[model samples]
Target: MTSATNPATEELTPFPDHTQLPDSDGTFVKNWQEHPQSILLTDSITPILKQLHPEGEYCIGQDLGIYWRLTDPPEKGAEAPDWFYVGNVPPLLDGLTRRSYVLWREFIAPTIVLEFVSGDGTEERDKTPWKGKFWVYEQVIHPAFYGIYEVQKASVEVYELIGGQYQLLSPNERGHYPIPPMGVELGIWQGEYQNTDLPWLRWWDLPGNLLLTGEERAEQERQRAEQEHQRAEQERQRAERLTAQLRALGVEPEA
Candidate 1:
């Protein structure tokens, strides 16, 4: 495709924007866990992301269409990952919420892309030319990290783009795949989230500390406050007992 700008008049040529892209293919094959999984991952890692992109120049796409190529159906040339993160892009495009991510308009690719596999998971790993999701990600879209998560098996596979090819990454000592740029590790955690008890995909810090969601952090703070209050009460009780003992011994207690 030629440049959107014409050098002759320096006028911008006609190009499709996010509004022009189709967001979905009208198919609903996602399981119940997919939506909550996306939220879980988003909520927990949001604090870290805010710190990383303090200026608020980052966007996350959850099951949103990323148009890499223009096709007849418009959705045919797109690959919508379960979740994706792209830094240095505004959450909104020119004060308008993005209907879809159009690569031709905004030349920025996502930093990481993840796919949640609901079946045998062959499609997520497919590498067929132009037709496979994996091939499109590795060759066309080319995110730095691509992850395939299978909740049924409680396993996740992460791939890194190295030397223009996707290389399977080995988990670190913490049994988590390291996403160095984000300074976090991706792994499965056995826990209950959104009222469902199962192994959910989660993120961990570089030192293997689990990143807490906003709700979890709030609960931790509440527990700490209660402990502090209990300690204060215990100290007050001890002081009162000492005062009474002093009075009983016929010594005047100091005010």
Candidate 2:
């Protein structure tokens, strides 16, 4: 029998490994509709970043906490970043909302973090006691960049971890920074998403320019087509006028 028709090859069945099984934790995340705009911003930027950095390992999402029990005993305090990332590490943490992102276990802390303020009037709380929280990320976590997106204020700010402290990375005219961790500068702007035009977080290049979404790109193409049509119409009208002038001069304009 030819190798192409080998029965052994056809009968091969893949077996599931029980020893290296996936995490089946039922840790719950309330539907993300609480802040619809933030959801769009997160959904839009993350997949692209992951796709671009296929070789690098990372995870970005909410309600999933990182458990930092790798070195110290599993700790009670777990911080859930709106969107957090750890480079060059497996994306799953015990298959559940991480108890705390223990750096030692994963051999790396999150490279960048994004915080979307829900505007529950806890700005002061976040600025003070929570200041220490981000401080931990700055001092201990040592993320290269930390972003705070304020939906109500339409403000986006990024803090770069510098010299064991958090230094605000000033935004250019467009309000963004070129962070190398994710290879994309995060920006805040007003745009259409889910049929609504409002403030949203956008990914940009190092040059501080907005990257267009598929929908936005399509809209631009439509606008360009309309402009081209108008220009052609204008040219046609001019040609007709010239033809009428030739007819009046008895030049007998051809059809």
Candidate 3:
């Protein structure tokens, strides 16, 4: 872990907690799609994460910072992934919402980090040491998987950390990147979400089933119930017709 130094004394003081860090850099989101994109990724994976961490020992950060070093201006040392997931850790620190992930205090690196490309994606792919996002995640944070999703191209590039370096992963037969840690795959789906029709990044199970959001799952259940009701109505009408046929043949139908 990189250490922070106080410029005044040239010595290390106690590292600041999440409370002391600047949560935001006062930078506006690059585009309108960023928020919805982040939400789509998070919403679809909530059920999978709950099943993975049944005791609620997990954290999901959407557009939140992971503080790796203590810099003069704290936000400079942090890289806020568009979306990230960490397991085996409490969702909240001391029963409070996490302002940001402080690495020194919480030693768990995220299981996966995803960056949504709003620009030409040079920043996400940049490999300059101590500065670039790719270099930091590969060397400092070292998540199991890192994904770059580009909406403009309707494509995603996933990398798996192997032997201390990120290996660009190839999609499987289903055209999705498999993440074994969570037994799920990452891929893009052309769909309408939040009233926006776009290619949204989503998750799938190992069996090639798309993970549905809460609303999607609800809609599925509603459709299933309607189908069952229709089947029952058809059965009732068939039984009534059979009774009428028996009456015409001069045989009373049993009650």
Candidate 4:
């Protein structure tokens, strides 16, 4: 959270309200094998970001179309990234659910956009200017960072927008790319998440701590409480042994 401060606190030109924006009408199609991974990525990252900014001033979207521009007759030009995060935007607009993320209305593009390579792999890396996912993200949406995760290969590629062009980012010694602005790193993790066993893309803090999901957090707390309980029980047993020895010696042990 050091460098990834809320943008809402900055002074900028007033943007249009959510009511004035056109809906992107993005629909999510379920891919039993791949869709769940996207959910796991979002689920893992959202809570960590929320904890960093407790004001509820961030938006983490999954498969929601990001409307980057307005066209003639008010066409919705949006491409839905598997997962995206925009810091400093309201989690909801005017207390209403967001149908799509409109860039013009929000006045801020997403800080990071992630696409999990599908089995076929045609769409995630498409480079056709107007219709390509890569083109739209690089030219129109212009996120600060873009990541592509290949589940099968267990590899990830991250690109940083340098001088309005995406430059390939090299991984550190730990095979993770550090996203300095967000105070996190992107890396591939091999394990079970959400009851599904697969290699999934995950986030880590600067100190190399894996961000935990709600379930994982609960499990950790449970372990700590159990450890404390065991320690207390051991102390009680030791005291009882000492009291018994004192009573055997005819010395009245105070309760």
Maximum-lDDT candidate = 3
Q: Rank the candidates by lDDT, best first.
A: 3, 1, 4, 2
* Candidate 3 deviation (Cα RMSD): 4.9
Candidate 2 Cα misplacement greater than 4 A, ranges: 1-35, 42-59, 62-64, 70-78, 85-108, 119-132, 180-184, 195-197, 252-255
Instruction: Tell me the tens digit of each residue's lDDT in model 4 across 1-255.
Output: 478768988889654444555555534464655567776677777767777779988888877768776655343466778788889888888789886788777768889999877666678777898888888998889999999888888899999999998899999988899998788899988898867777788889888989887788899999999999999999999999999999999999876
lDDT per model vs. reference: 0.92, 0.62, 0.93, 0.81
- For candidate 2, the 10 contiguous residues with the lowest summed lDDT are 15-24
Model 1 per-residue lDDT tens digits across residues 1-255: 886866788776677888877888999957889999999999999999999999999999998999988799889989999999999998898799988889988898888999999888999999999999999999999899999999999999999999889999998888899998898999999999988899999999999999999999999999999999999999999999999999999988879
Best by TM-score: 3
Q: TM-score each candidate.
A: 0.93, 0.61, 0.94, 0.81
List, in order, the clash count of every candidate structure: 0, 7, 0, 0
Model 4: what TM-score?
A: 0.81
The positional error of residue 39 in candidate 1, measured at the CA in angstroms, is: 0.6
lDDT of 3 by residue, 1-255 (tens): 987876987766888999889889999988789888888778888888889999989999988999999897889999999999999998888888999999999999999999999899999999999999999999999899999999999999999999999999999999999999999999999999999899999999999999998899999999999999999999999999999999999999889
The full ranking of all candidates by TM-score, starting with the best, is 3, 1, 4, 2
Alpha carbon deviation, residue 68, candidate 1 (Å): 0.9
**Scored by Cα lDDT, where does model 2 land?**
0.62
Residues 1-255 of candidate 2 have per-residue lDDT tens digits of 654687866877543221222222344443243356446555556655667668645655454454432222223334566666666765555565444455545557677777776654254124344234565566555677788777678887788878777788877665677777566777776766777776777788666656666666688999999999999999999999999999999898877
Q: Model 3 Cα displacement at 152 (Å)? A: 0.6
